[model samples]
Target: MFRNTKMRLGGVNILLLTIVISLIVLYRSTSYCLCKVSPVEEAFGQPMKSQPRPDSGEHRVTCHIPGLESRKQFYQYFTEKEYKCENLRWFGSRDGRKAVCMDMEFYLVPQDCHVLSFGINNEWSFDDKFGAMGCKVYSFDPTMGKADHQRSQNVQFFRLGISNIKGQRKVGMGSRFDFFEVDRYVNILERLGLTNTTIDYLKLDVELSELEFFQDVFRNTPHLLRNIKQIAVELHHGYHGKGLNKTEDITDDSSDMSPISTYQIFWQYFHELRCHGFKLFHARRNGRWTEAVWGNI
Candidate 1:
C-alpha cells in the first residue's frame, strides 16, 4: 500500500512538469517577425527632394502617387526627432475631435460631433474640425438620439456604427438591431450612397475587443482597411471579442500589456496593417496609449 501511494504521487509530479514545459515552448513559438516593407514603406523614406515644408507650419502632402509610398521618409524625419509625439505634426485638427494631439492623432472639431461620433457617448465630443476633410463617420449605437448633422460643405455623418457587415446581430442597450450590411467599410460607404467615395484618413478607437469584427468583417472588405491614407489604433489586451471566441488558445494579459510580453494579438494586428501599406513612422513611448501613424506621413 505504501509503495503504490508513492508511485501515484511521483507520476502526478512528472505530469505537471511536462505540462509546464509545454506551455513555455508554446509561449516562445508565437513571436512574429516583421515582413518586408510595402511600397508605401519604401516611398516614405526617400529624401523629399521636390516637396518642401509649407510655411503655414502645418505639414501635409496632397500629392498622389499611383503606388506612391513615403513611410521611410516620414520615419527619417521623425526619427531625427526621436519619435516624440509633440514634435510631429502632419494631421490637422479644428475642434477637440480633430486635435491631433500627443495621444489622439486626428482632426478636431467639437461643433460637428455627429460627423464621427453618432451620439452614442454624450461624453463624445469633437472640436469643430473633426472630419472636416469629408471623412464620413458612422456609429451603430442604438441609443443615438435623432439630430440634424449638417455638412460643412465637405463632412458627412451617420447615426450608426459602420454596419457594413450584413446579418450580424446589432445588440444595443440589451436589444437586437438589424440591417443588411456589406463586408467592408467601403460597403458601408456604398450602402450610404457614397460608392465612389474614398477615406483619406481613418480612426478606430472602438475598444480593443472589436478586433474580431475587423477580422471577420472589416478584412473581407478591401477598401476600409486599405483605402485610408492614415491610421491611429489603440492596442489593448484581454478585451474580449469575437477572435477570442474562435481561438481557445488566445492569451489574456490584462495584468500586463507590454509588447515585449505576450503580444500575439498585437503582433497579428500590426502585421496586417503593415501588409496593407502602413509602415510605422512614429509611435509613442513604451507602455503609453500610442498614436502611431503610417502612410505618406
Candidate 2:
C-alpha cells in the first residue's frame, strides 16, 4: 500500500511539471505576438526606419557657394547686437500677428502720424492697432480685388502693388502663382501727395521683391526713407526668394534687372539702410525669414 501511494505521488508531480512548462511557452508566445502588433509600429512604420539626413547631397552642392561665408559673417554680426527693452519694446501679438518693436523714441508720435504699409495678405492687426491710435494708415496690395477695398474705416486700402519699376510684370517664385499689374512705389507715393510728409512708420513685407524695391527706393527716393521714423520689414532671404544661386539664369527678359546672389542683395540693402542712419534695433526669426525693425535713432 505504501509503494502504490508513492508511485501516485510521483505521477502527480510529473503532471504538475508538464503543466508549468506549457504555461511558460504559452506566455512567451503571447508576448511575442503582442510585440508584433505594436500600435506605434503599425501606424508609422518601424520605429527604427531610416530618416532623411539633415545634410543631403543638395546641401553639399550649395554649401560652399560664394557669398555664403559673407552671409554667415553678417548673420553673426546681426545676432550679436545688444537690444534694450526700454528703447525697443515688443508690441502686438507674440505669435507673429503684428509683433514689432514699439521704438518709443521713433514710433510714438504726437498726432497725425502717417503709416505706409506695403504687402497685404489679409493681415491688418498692426494697421488696426496703429489706426486706433489715431494714425492715418495707407495699405497697398495689388492682389486685392475691388470688392475687398476699404477693409477698415481708419485704414485706406488701395488695390495697388509696390515695385521698383512701374507697370505689370509676372512675379512668381518656384511653383507658385505669378502676380500682375504691380505699380511703382515712388509713383504711388507721389500721386497720393505723400511727398515731403513724415511717414511715422513704414512697414514692408513684400516677399522677395523687397530686395529690388529697397535698392530702387534707396537710389530714387532717399528722402522718402529718411522721412520715415521707423521701418519694419519681413526679410525673406532663402533660395526661393531673392537668394537664388548667381549661376542660375533668369528667363524673364522683361525684368531689366540682372540676377544677383542673396548675400549681395541683402548686404547692399542693409548697408544702404545703415548708411541712411537707420539703426537695426530688433530682429526676430520666423523659420527661413526674419522680421527686422529699423528705427531712426
Candidate 3:
C-alpha cells in the first residue's frame, strides 16, 4: 500500500510540472504576438510602440517668454515643446521642400482634399505627390514664369502669388527690373469659388512674404483661417534684404525691429494661433528658415 501511494504522488507532481511549462510557453507566445510589428509601420519605417520608461516625461512642456531680449528663450520655445502625432508621413521632395505630419488624425483621407501650395518655384514634386493621392492641388508661383494651366490630372499651376494686398503689386528679388503680380488670400478664395469650402491644407513657401500674408489673414480676414484645416508655412526671419517689394502704404515694422523683437513677434503669432486652436505638430530648420506645420485641432 505504501509503494502504490508513492507512485500516485509522483504522477501528480509530474502533471503539475507539465502544466507549469505549458503556461510559461503560452505567456511567451502571447507576448510575442502582442509585440508583432504591423505592416504599415514596417513600410513607413515608423518605430514600434514600446513601454514608456519611468524617467521619460512624455508630457507637453510650455515655453514661457519673459522678455524680448531672450533670444535663447525664443529658440528654446520652438525646440522644447512636444506635440505628439501618431501617424506622420512625409510628402514632397527628399530635400527640404517636403512637408511633415501630412497623415495626422485630422488629415487621414486624401480623397477630394484641396491643397493650396504657395511658392512652387518649379518644384512640382510636392504638388504632384499630393495630387496623386487624389487631392486637388493648386500650385502658385509668380516667379516660375509658367502661365496658369493644368500641370497634371489634379495639379494646377498658376502664375499668381500670395500677398496682403488684393490688387496687382510689383514684386522683385532686390532688383528693379524683375517683378510679378500677387493677390490677397481672400481674393484668391473668392476667385476659385472656395470661399465657402474647407481647405484641407494650405502650404506657404512664399519666401519672406509669409509674415505679411499671415498678418493680413489673422488681422483682416480671421474668418478665412477657420476654413483651413492645416497650415505648413516656412517662416523667414533675419533676412532684411530687399526680396519682395513691401507695400508702401502697409506699415511693416518688421524691418525696423531688432532680431530679438522679430523673434518675439513670431512667438506672438504662434501664441495667437494656439489661442485659435491651432497646434504646432512638426518643425524643421533649414539654414535660417524654419518649416512649421500647424494643424487645427
lDDT of 3 by residue, 17-111 (tens): 99999999999878866665544345436533343322222322244434544445556656754467677777877443665564445664668
* Residue-by-residue lDDT tens digits, candidate 2, 276-296: 667777776877778787776
Ranking by lDDT: 3, 2, 1
The parts of candidate 2 lying over 4 Å away from their true place are: 1-68, 82-96, 99-104, 146-148, 241-243, 246-259
lDDT of 2 at 250: 35
How close is every model to the real structure, measured as TM-score? 0.45, 0.66, 0.68
Q: Write the per-residue lDDT of candidate 1 for residues 119-220, one digit (tens) a residue.
A: 234433441234453434553333345453643454444444533244443432212233322233434555665443344444554333235444643233
Q: Lowest summed-lDDT stretch of 10 residues in model 3? A: 52-61
Better of 1 and 2 by TM-score: 2
Find the candidate with the highest lDDT and give its number.
3
Look at candidate 2 and tell me the lDDT of residue 185: 65
Off by over 4 Å in 1: 1-87, 90-120, 123-127, 131-143, 151-154, 167-184, 193-196, 216-219, 240-263, 284-291
Ten residues in a row with the worst lDDT in model 1? 48-57
Estimate candidate 3's RMSD in Å: 17.1
Number of clashing residue pairs in every model?
A: 39, 0, 0
